[model samples]
Target: MKIGYGHMGTLTMVVELLLEELGHEPVVPHRPTRQTLALGAKYAPEFACIPFKIVLGTYLECLERGADTLLSGGGYGPCRAGMYGEVHGRILRDLGYNPQVIFLFPPLIKPYHFFKKVSLLKGRCSWFHLARAIRKAWTKLTFLDQMELLSQTKRPRELTRGATSKAFERGLTYLHQAKSLNEIIEAGHAALAELDQVPVDPAADPLKVGIIGEIYVQLEPFANHYIEETLGHLGVEVRRSIYLTSYTRHDVLSTKGDMSSRSLAMPYLNQKIGGHGQNSVGDVIRYAKLGYNGVVQLAPFSCIPEIVAKSLMPYLSKKYGIPVLTLFIDEQTGPTGIQTRLEAFVDLMEQRRAQTREGARMQTGSAV
Candidate 1:
């Protein structure tokens, strides 16, 4: 079957690879655009979050492009994301489209159901083939995450403006077109080498910023108005608290780390609170402890969990002595406004750093 899914940064490309490996035609649409956002907002529920609207538009575009099936991730808890697949299916059916909709839930929740769904999508591929395909996809996903983090680190230090971004884009293209394990490895190595070639200032001390927020807004550039790229251009190093691989490890693979988000957040939030609200709190505390200059929280407008996280920002900021900026995004959010806020935030971070250095110098002089 011809399958379609939403545009989520490098994730769409990974899903495309997976579908192709399973012998199905993948109808991936272009990255989320203004037109796509408009179409989705026009059809989605009035109060539905931005991600739902954007994905709905993506699905419509895919269906128009001849996709017979739609695939989406499922959620659990107080987050509304768990209902997205069913709602999207209903909307499509009401609009007279009858494409099959599949929701891939976490395997640990319902192993039999998850495997059954996977078997359906695997089509004629044997179990071993499916395993190989998944391995290749996972490898590509991990590489993409590393590539992004590298770009963020390099962007602020590159001697030439936009040099790191240009190299990063080239690397993404190389990985996107790669079809084999060897090719994937080659693309990764070549990409990393190209990034390493970008001339960087050894003495440049860029402001360090950690981004904590809802997964969709954090990962999807269009949704967050390309906040990471904007920050990078402003000479700030950005670190995201979430990535697909990280999510897979924590949620899908159930790999427990020494410091889980829940444990970190328990002192403050003490409950799941749906979505990444709890994680946001935990991640902010972690960022502060790691000595980041500041933190930015990106949440879809009206997102409850993020709202809760935002509400706690002042407390976190005051106690941790780190600045926090909360941005609520929606269809009405403009790039200009976001740019202005980011510029101001960068300045604030710089001022804080300068004052910190002055204080340390004064203390040393007094001791002497």
Candidate 2:
């Protein structure tokens, strides 16, 4: 089957590798075209969520380009993602195509169960096939994951011209090709070389903003109105809490820790907040310690976890002495509004920078 996948950060990487390794023709759909979104805008109900609209555009574009099936994820609980497969299927049917949609929902291991559940998706031949597929996927996933971890570590000291982006490009390339264990190894080695080749700038003042929030909004640049790039253009260095590898790890391994998992934005909120939002708080705190000037928290209009995060951010701001701004988006979100808020945030950061440097100069004068 000619399989088509929706882009979901590094998930696209994993899907492409699996399909190619399994000998299926995998078509990478053109980055959701304007026409595709227009079609989805007309076809989707007025009330459909933003992500559904975006994903629908992806599937529609893939189908037109000759993909015979839809390869995506599965449904779980509370989160709309759990039901995205069904919703997407219904949308496809309403529009007329009933292609095969394979969702790879990773299962969690339990006390009595030896293996986890792959919800709605089954291993082709036996448990052995499933094990091999998973093992192969992990080898690729982990290597790409470690590269990002290394980046955040070096990012603070390495924020000069071309340094961080060079590292990011390398990681993206390796992740783009991470298919099998052998490919994963080769890709990582090559990426490390690229990172080493790029030199960090000595005297660069990069605006360091920490982005924390819901996973979809955080990772999908288009969905977030290209916040990272916009910030970059303004000479601000944007760091995000969402890591492709960390999200995957939590998806497969953190079920045990999930119950105790706290809010991702503000620990003071102390709510499970549901979904990956809870885990993001730890990421935010980590970034604050790493010297981010401020944090901008984005949440879908009705996302409970992020709402909880917003509720507690005042305390986080006080405790950490960092500015925290929350942006709530919904169907009505427009580019102009996002642009305005971003400009304001950047302005605020500029003021903060001036104050810090002024204070430093004052101390120097006093010493002299």
Candidate 3:
């Protein structure tokens, strides 16, 4: 079986590992681009969210490349994500590409159901092989996440603006091509080491900002116009509120973790509003308390959950005394417009920081 799946942030890497272990050839869709968006938007419902459009485009691309099986994560909440697979499958059928569609939305609450879903894909594999596949995937994920996080720090301080990014791309290529768990680990270390050697201003006090929004835009650089890297280029430190490893381990695999968003967003949103709305609200508050200079919320244009969260940004900004910038993105978005807004936001944060430090010094002098 040649398995193909739409990319969902870092989950694509993990899923690719699983398909290979299951004795199936993994069909990787082309990386998202303007053309990808155009293809997806051409056939997608006019009002569907960006992720749906992009995933559909990916599937179409995969189908053209001879992928016979398509996989998508199933959703169970009020979020449109829950119904994407069904919609995508129907779209594919209508377009004459009747690939085997698999939705990995097995009931996480029911072990038997989850195992059953796994067994179908495993074919003739033993439990041991399944476990090995999972372990290797998890290991790769850990390494990749670490390398990514390290790159975030280096992006702002590196002497050469895009050096860290280049090194990271190379490292990712090596990590992805590695055959075994040990090789993956070695590749990760090598990647980190290469990034570490990049010249950086150790004393650079870059303005720190936390990114909070829908998980897809927050994690997918292409989807969000590479907002994080843009911030770094503008001399801002970036921290995303969600990472795939933590999200998978805490939210999906285990139930024991401090979901600070639930508690932090209580004043404004007492209940889950679906998607990562709670995380959006809570993470902004958390970043404010952490002394971050500012917060930026990236949401897809017309995304209901993020739209709801965006409405509450003013209240959070006023309460925390921090600046907030919310940017809504769509295929029509232009990089020039995004870059201008980001530059303005960075300038605003720098001015605010200067005023803050000046006030602190004035207060100290008055006391003295």
Candidate 4:
């Protein structure tokens, strides 16, 4: 089987590796581009989240390239993502393309069904081989996430514009081409080293911002207009609340630690509202406690779960004393508009931080 999946940041690379190891040919779609978004938006339901449209477009591209199978993640909640596979398949069939669509749900929720689906793809590969392949992919995923975290910290302080981004991309390329576990480890170390070498101003005290919202928008640069890079260019240190590794650990593996997002969110949201709504609320509170300057919520227009989270933003901001900016994204969301809003938000954070420092100083002086 020739398998195809959507471009989801570095996660795509991991999927590609897994498919190859499973003895299937992987049809890697190009990263989401303007044309890709247009194609997806054209066929997808007008009200569907932008991620659905984009992934649909990705599948269309894969089909055009002769892919026979489409793989996607499924949700088990009120989120619209649970219906994506069915909807995507129907749309493709209507358009006269017949491909096998597979949706991987959380294994913890339906282990038997999940393994049954996995068996279909494993084919001639032994169970041991499959396990090894997954281990390798997981390792690569961890390293890829580490590189991203390093880039987020370094990008804001780098003296040369785009230097950290370039190094980060180079590291991604190296890791993607790596054929062995040793190579993967080497690539990860090399990538971090290169990022560390980028010249940065020691005196630069960049504004720290936490990103929270729908996973798709948080992870996909195209979906969010490359907000992380944009924020870094504006000299803001950005940290995302989700990554594939962490999501898998907490959501798929069901191994929530004592300070899990669900636990942290109990004060604001008592239960899961579907998608990452609860996590968004929890992570924002977490960031505030960590002294982040602000938090940005990215959600697709009409995303129900995110909308729930957005409704509580004002309350969260006021109680936490942290500024919150929510950006609703769609195919029509333009970079210029996002950039302007980001600049204003950053300025607001900066002013707020300065005032906080002055207040602290005045209080200390009065006591003295």
Q: Please report the candidate that would top lDDT against the real structure.
A: 1
Q: Write the per-residue lDDT of candidate 4 for residues 157-257, one digit (tens) a residue.
A: 99999999999998888888986778878887887888888889999899999999998899999899999999999999999998889888777778242
Model 2: runs farther than 4 Å from truth? 109-136, 142-180, 256-267, 280-286, 301-304, 330-336, 360-368
lDDT of 2 by residue, 1-368 (tens): 78887765555667677666556678876555456556666777666556667778888888888888887756456566678778888889888898987765555534222233242233354556656776777767676656554554345446464475577776777667566667777887777666555554557577788888877777766667767666665666676766666656655556633332343334444544465566556555666778788888878676766776677678777787788888876556888888888889889978988999999999999999
Give the per-residue lDDT of model 1 (tens digit) for 26-80. Answer: 9987899999999999999989999999999999999999999999888776788
Q: Is candidate 2 or candidate 4 better by TM-score?
A: 4
Model 3, span 1-368: residue lDDT tens: 88888876666877888889889888977678888889999999988888888889999888888899997767656678778899999999999888998776635555686676678889898889989988999888888788778888999999998998898888878888876888878887888898888899999889999998887888778899988889998998898888888878656665322278768988888876667777788888999999999999988888888888889999889999889999988888899999999999999999999999999999999999
- All candidates' lDDT scores? 0.91, 0.67, 0.84, 0.90
Error of 1 at 213 (Å): 0.6
Ranking by lDDT: 1, 4, 3, 2
| Two-way TM-score contest, 3 vs 4, winner | 4
RMSD of each: 1.3, 4.3, 1.6, 1.3
Structural similarity to truth (TM-score) of each candidate: 0.98, 0.78, 0.96, 0.98
lDDT value, candidate 1, whole model: 0.91
lDDT (Cα) of model 4:
0.90
Candidate 1 is scored at a TM of: 0.98
Once fitted onto the true fold, the runs of candidate 4 whose alpha carbons sit more than 4 angstroms away are 255-259
Better of 2 and 3 by lDDT: 3
How big is the positional error of residue 325 in model 4, measured in Å on the Cα after superposition? 0.1
